[model samples]
Target: MGILNQAVQLAIMVGTIRTLSWPSANESRNANPPEKAVHRQIGSDFDYLMLTRIFPTAVCRADDDSVPDSCEIPTDTPEWSIHGLWPNFKNGSYPQFCDGSPRKFDSDLIKSIEGRLLRMWPNLYPAKTAHSFWKHEWEKHGTCSQNHKNLSSELLYFRTTMAIDTEYSVGSALERAGIIPRSEPYHLEDIRDGLMKELSHGMHVQLNCLTDKKTRQILLGDVRMCIDKSFQPIDCPRSNAFQPATYFTGHSAPLPSFKECPPLVTYLLETSTEPSHMLGLGHREFAYWINPLIPFYTGFFSQQKLKHELLWGITVPFMAVAIFIYVEGGRGG
Candidate 1:
C-alpha cells in the first residue's frame, strides 16, 4: 500500500513537470511557412523607400471592425515588429507584383538569419505562418525594389530591413523619452515629439493611429520612416504620400489614417493576468494545462467547444486520481 501511494505521487510529479516545461524559443524554430503566388504587373520607377513597424498590443486590442484572430501579442515589455520595407513613387503611388521571374521568396535565403527575423519581424497574426507574411511582403512590395542595387535580392531586402529596424526601433525611442506602454492615454504631440527627437539628421517619421470603435479613442498603429536610394534616413515627403495605400491589408476599405489621432491616444500593455508570448502555445491550451480555475480568462476561451474541451481535459484526470485514492483507502481500512 505504501509503494502504491509512492508510485501515484511520483506519476503526478512527473506529469506536472512535463506540463509546466513547455518548449523554449530555441526549440521551436523549425516552422515551415507556406509560399504565396505572385502575379505579373508592369514595374515602375521609385523615389524612396518606407519602413513600417507595427505596435502589436494596440493592433490586437484597438480595432473593432475586423480584429485579427491570432495576433502574437508580446509580454508586458513593449516592442514594435516589422511590417515591410516598401518602394514608393513620389506621388504616394507604389508598384507591386513586379517581375522577379527567377526569384521567389526562398526561405533558404534567410535560413542563416531566421532566428533574428522571428524575433524582430514576427507575423502578428498567428493563424498565418510567419513565412506566409514574408512571402506576401516579398511578392507584393520587395519585388518592386529589384531596380535598387542594395535591395535587388531577397536576402538583401530582408537583411536591410532587419538592420534598419534595429537602428531605429520605436519601442526603444519611446522608452528613452519616458513614454512607456500603459493603460493610460498620452498626448499626441508628446508621442510625436518623443519619436522625432531621437531620429538622426533631422529625419521625419509618419505617425499613424487607429480608433477603437467601442470607446472611440485613438491608439497607435504604425510608425513609418523613409530612406533614400542610398539607404540613408531622410524626411518623408510633405505630400499625402503618408496616406496608406490600398494594398495595406488586402482589404478594399481605406487603411487607418495618419495624423488623424485624437489629442489623447491609448497605448495598451499586456496585463499580468494574461499569458505571455513565450508559452509556445495558444491562449486556450496554455490556460487549460496551467490553470483551469481562472474564470477571468473567459475572454480568451470564448468558443463554446473550446471551453468544453478544456473543462474535460482538466477535470477528468483529477477525478480519476481522487477515485483511485478513495478505493485504496477503503481497502486499507
Candidate 2:
C-alpha cells in the first residue's frame, strides 16, 4: 500500500518536473519584486553554512578575463574563487532577507579588499558592474544570517567571507590531493577526499556542477562547504531546503543544479596560453546559468555569440515533486 501511494506521488511529481521551464532572463529579472518586511524567525541556527566560491575561468563563459584597466586581479588567483557565504539548512532550503536590515554595502569595507574582490568576486552577467551584485547579496542573504552578532555587522559579513576564502582555496586544496584540473574525469569521491585534507573540520561539502544547458557540456561552478554558527565544520545535515516563494511571494527559491555529480568529471584548468579552439570544456568562451539562489546574482542566462549559448534552470512547482520521486523512488516508493 505504501509503495502504491508513492507511485502515485511520483507520477504527479514527474509530470510537474516536466512542466518546469525557464522564462527569459529578462523576464525573471524584471519580475516585480515582493515588498520587504522584517523576518521574525528563520529556524534554529543553521545545521551548516556553505561558503560557495565561483571559478570564472572554469565556466564556459565569454566574459573578458582581462581585468579592467582601473582594477587589478592578483597574479595567482584561481580560475574560480569567492562567490559568497550563504546560510543553508541540511535539507537545502534556507531563509532569505531574515531582517529588514537596510540594504547597504560599505564602500570603504569593500575598498579595503578591492583587489581580491576585483579578481575573485566577479559579476558574470554584466561586463563590469560588480557593485550591484554585492548589494543584492547583502540585502537578500547576509542580513538573513542568524549569526549576525558573530558577524557583528555588514562589514564583518564581507570581511569574514574573505577570511574564509583566504583560508580555503578549493583550487589549492584539490591540487594538494592530486586532483589537477584541465584534463580527464575525476571521481566525485576523490574530489571530496582531496578537500578533506585542507577542510579538516568535517567532510561536509557539496560540489556544484555548472551545466551548459545549451552547449550540452558541464564544468565546475562552486564548491560549497558546511560551517556551524561558531564557524566550525560539521557533518552536513541532509538538505531539506526551504521554499522561499511560498513564504515570500515573488521570491524564487534557491537550489543547486544537481545534488550529486556523475561518477567522473574533470576538475578543469584554464590555459590562456592555448587558443580556445585547441582546448575544450574548461577553456571555452560560452555563458552559462545564473545561480538564482545566489544573492545579488541576476541570472547570466542572457546570451553572447558563443558557440554554446545557455539558459537558466526552469524548475516548476511539479519539479520539486519530481525530485521527491527521484530521491525517494528506491525507498519502497
Candidate 3:
C-alpha cells in the first residue's frame, strides 16, 4: 500500500504514472538497516534457510479475484512455486539486511532463467509491476545470508534456490504420496504426513495458509522446510517453526503466531479470471479492506466529500452589479 501510495503521489507530481520502476532512492543499495544489539551480540547464526514454496494462484485466488498485469503463470507450472528461502535465527529472530553489501542487484542476471523463475517466484502483485520480486528478495533475505554459508552472490542465490526447487518439487512430492489439490478441505496433519513419506529425510515442514476471515476457510499458502548449510532439506527445528521469543525471553514483545498454516485448511483449485498480478489487491484493494470500515462505506456517500478548493489562502466573497439607462429616457421628451 505504501509503495502504491508513493507511486500515486509521484504520479500526481509528475502528471504521469512514469515507468513501473521506483525512483532513484529505492533503486540504490539499501541504506544500512539499524542493528539489533541482541541479534549481533548473541551472535545469531541461522542453522538454515527455510526454503519455502507456494501455489500463489490457488491460495491468492481463493481469497482474491484481481490478478495484476505482470503475472504470467505458466500452464505447465506444476505444484507450488518458490515463496522464499528465509534465514532462521536459533531464537527464531531471523537476520535481514545483514551486512549492507554495496553491490546492487542486476536485474539482467535473471533474464536467462526467466522461464524457470516465472514458474517458481514470479511477482504475486502489481501484474504490470516492475520485476521487483528478485530485488526485494535479495535486499530483504539473500543479503542476510553469508557467502561461505550457502548463497554467495545474487546469481548463486537464485540458481541454488532453483536447483533446490527442482530437486524437491513440493507438488510432485505430495502427489507421489496420493495428496493432490482439489475443492475439498483437508486436515493439516494429512497433508504433512503425505509429504513426509516422499521426502528423503522425512522433513519436518510447516504448511502456511491464507484464510478467508469471513468464511473462516483456511487455504494452503506456502510449504516451508528446513535446508542445512549444505543445501540439503532437513527437519525444521520446532523452535524455528514457532519462535518462542516471548516465552523464553519473558519480555513484553509479542510472539509471532503460526497463522500461515492453521488447522482445518483447504486445497481448493481456483476457478476465476486469471489476471496478471497478485490477487489480494487487484480484485479488492487491501488498504481499504484493512480499515474495517469498508462494509459501511459506500462510493455514493464518499463522492460528495471529494470536492477541493484551489485557493492557497483565505478568501472573501463579494457580489458585482451593473446599471444601464433605458431607451425610455429619450422618449420622455
- lDDT of the candidates, in the order given: 0.64, 0.51, 0.54
Give the poorly placed runs of model 1, Cα more than 4 Å off.
1-44, 63-68, 74-78, 101-103, 213-216, 242-248, 251-259, 271-333
User: Which wins on TM-score, candidate 1 or candidate 2?
Assistant: 1
Which digits, one per residue and each the tens of the lDDT, describe model 1 over residues 224-290? 8888888787887656344452233553332233345667887655432222333323334444564
lDDT ranking from best candidate downward = 1, 3, 2
Ten residues in a row with the worst lDDT in model 1?
Answer: 28-37
Query: Per-residue lDDT for 30-73 in model 3, tens only?
Result: 32223321122111255567787776554444333332232234
Task: Return the lDDT, model 3, position 115.
Answer: 79
Model 3 worst lDDT window (10 residues): 316-325
| Shift of residue 143 alpha carbon in model 2, Å | 0.4
| Candidate structures ordered by TM-score, highest first | 1, 3, 2
Per-candidate alpha-carbon RMSD to the true structure: 24.3, 22.2, 23.6
lDDT of 2 by residue, 184-274 (tens): 5677777777777666355666776644332334556557777777777766544534222121111221211332456666565444222
* TM-score for predicted model 2 compared with the true structure: 0.57
Off by over 4 Å in 2: 1-47, 61-77, 90-92, 106-109, 200-202, 212-215, 238-260, 272-333
Return the TM-score for each candidate structure: 0.62, 0.57, 0.59
